[model samples]
Target: MYTGNLSNLILNSDSYKTSHWAQYPSGSEYLSSYIEARKGDYDVVFFGLQAFIKEYLSTPITHQDIDEAEMVIQAHGLTFNRAGWERLVDKHGGYLPLRIEAVPEGSIVPVSNVVCQVINTDPEFYWLPSYIETALLRAIWYPSTVASVSHYCKGIIRQALEKSADSSDSLTFRLHDFGARGASSQESVALGSLAHLVNFAGTDSMTALVAASRWYRMDKDMPAFSIPAAEHSTMTAWGRDGETAAFANMLTQFGGAGKSVSVVSDSYDLWNAIDNIWGGCLKDEVQNMGGTLVIRPDSGEPAKVVREALERLAVKFGTTINSKGYKVLPDYVRIIQGDGISPNTLGSIIDVVLKAGFSADNITFGMGGGLLQQVNRDTMSWAMKASAICIDGVWKDIYKDPVTSRSKRSKKGRLALINQTQGQPKTIKLDDLSTTDNLLRDVYVDGKLLIDDSLTTIRERAGW
Candidate 1:
């Protein structure tokens, strides 16, 4: 009897799901459902399903889990399907008799297209597909929404870099993940940060690194990188008078040839730190550091502060015009706007910096709550709905047409995601398309993980 109090898959769902096994049609033997970003601002970056599978679904549910779940369900005044759960444990060894097909991890699928499809493999477990919807939908939405937001930010940065810089070489590091501390949990940060890493290669989230290594097979080559950087505590510990000393220590410790380090420079005052401290007293040291000293401004409106800071830094440290006619910060100096950044403001900040005649390369962003914790499931309008069902071995189309909200109208029949060759993928009837043409691949089948994707492969699928 496995008694470890870790998560039990049987109980990892909404309480209402406990009674769903008895509510399905009398002769129902299988249920087919699909998940998609119904309609949203950005295409879904299909990702993190592999992590969900490895973490939750791959493990066999023990008889101990069934017993414990039944006890809890009954106590909650919900009907527990003891017979169904016991049957699953005995017949399938607690492995879900379901097949999960999804777009390859990191594939950017347009909104309203199927990102994942679920169907129970065993005829006896008709409710299994919908029963797992709570976990399955959650596993897809949060990470995919974060990835979509990150991808949107990347697009904004790409446009800025192309217009203001000589090359887009610095694009990957233009946005850094400072989201670990702001996330709700270590698991949340791990998944959220990994989503950001799909488009960018910088992060301070250690859990994301472990997640990528463990689930995405990034051990041999780590996917994300972060430089030694200072925070408020580190800078403020020196007192306002000792702020310059603290900044100097950071450069001395982490600065070297062809290296990078970040230091928060707005402890007492942003203007004084840039003008007197960094530009006046420490100008020589900064210029001679043989690397980049990324100065971070934590307060004030991001766009306005970055524009002002760039002007002051240009006056003191000097800047050269790039090939794109934008002022490029010297090799040793840069800026990072870490506060108050979101999808709306990130582009605005970059636009301000670029419009000030500074190259996009002169500034990077460190996002905290805006990157990880700000979004919810509806940010992408994600939902999983039952689309088809098999009753007494007869398949039929099914859907929910909610008159209250036309956007909530669910897809119908067994679905297949097929690339249109010119535009985004289209969700069509599975019977209408050949299996080879379907973008949705069988990633998980009856407890077996079929596609073990690496972070590199996923990145490539997301356009790197």
Candidate 2:
């Protein structure tokens, strides 16, 4: 379960108090009410705090046990009381609104493309910077990482498919996202990786189904597989016994339901089991019963296992049995490869499988950690420097950097982000608002969010 302790830390931090320490105008009263109503929900408070503490604090605090005495004193100092917080909220006008020109959620964006931007909801509440920084950064980083990797995998899959002779079979490719339960963070594991898969246009509907049910208000029983004519689907079952009754029972169950069964065939002696159970017995049963059988090799060298399985199928089921298309008996029994498949390994396996007279279409890939844990180490550093502060009806750029480095300098004057989609890329300085043809549009105005794009919409926009 995801404990929202990070949210709590942000709410109860002195930095938050310092940032959103002002009052707002009449139009932005909703922001004020929101902060007031949820002031005492310490769980939410702790959730916000977790992010802040992780970023700012030198030492770690146990999420299981927080020091209450220290918390009370810190909360008091941070102005957590009703009156003080209301005063702060009123001063800042209840919320800070950010106008961002992000590279949409799923797009394969390189480093230095402004992924997002944040600003005050009310111009007067510009002081609320530190309070929002943690959440904003955390939200963008991991999802972007997953999306980038997924985009790379798409290229790899396309390349593999291009080298195949049977182009018709490429359309039925499956890419599964098996990283959710093992991702670095629980939020990223569940939500961020789902965003990645959705963006990549993958066939793993289970990830999307779970995300929709949990995060968005969608029906849980929504089907994962669909087609215009027939509803084709895949079902997985595992067992250790080579020719035991358990394997027979499962085969019967799968065959009875009019669904193709993919059995894990390498539990005992992989070669022996395939010959005795799958090739000798189950093959005839499934063929006579009008069912398809798929053998899954979950261990050892994928190429070797696939070659051995194919040879066994040929000898036992007869060399004349067609393994392609939907008509023949052995055609129903295919090999699905899993376990420790990296990009390089997958490439090598494809080479070997095709060389042995087995078409690339004969195998299925179930990839996991190699794609998920892979990182593009390129660093894209982001810093929000104070651009301008108003004083006595005059605005001036506020620039300050304690350590001066050539690359770390901030652009001065009243700045506006000019995005020229048609022309050459350049940053132009504007002294007056009317000077530029296009300026950064307000995404969130007066604490009311204007850009409300759904996850699916964002995923499509990613185009991985």
lDDT per prediction? 0.90, 0.46
- Candidate 1: regions farther than 4 A off: 1-6, 434-436
Which RMSD values do the candidates have, in order? 1.7, 10.3
Q: How well does model 1 score by local distance difference test? A: 0.90
lDDT of 1 by residue, 329-421 (tens): 788999988899999999899878887889998889988899899999888889999999999889999999979999999999999988786
In candidate 2, what are the lDDT values of residues 279-343, reduced to their tens digit?
76666785665655667767887878877777777667753313342112255666667667666
Best by lDDT: 1
Lowest-sum lDDT 10-residue window in model 2: 37-46
* 89 Cα displacement, candidate 2 (Å): 2.9
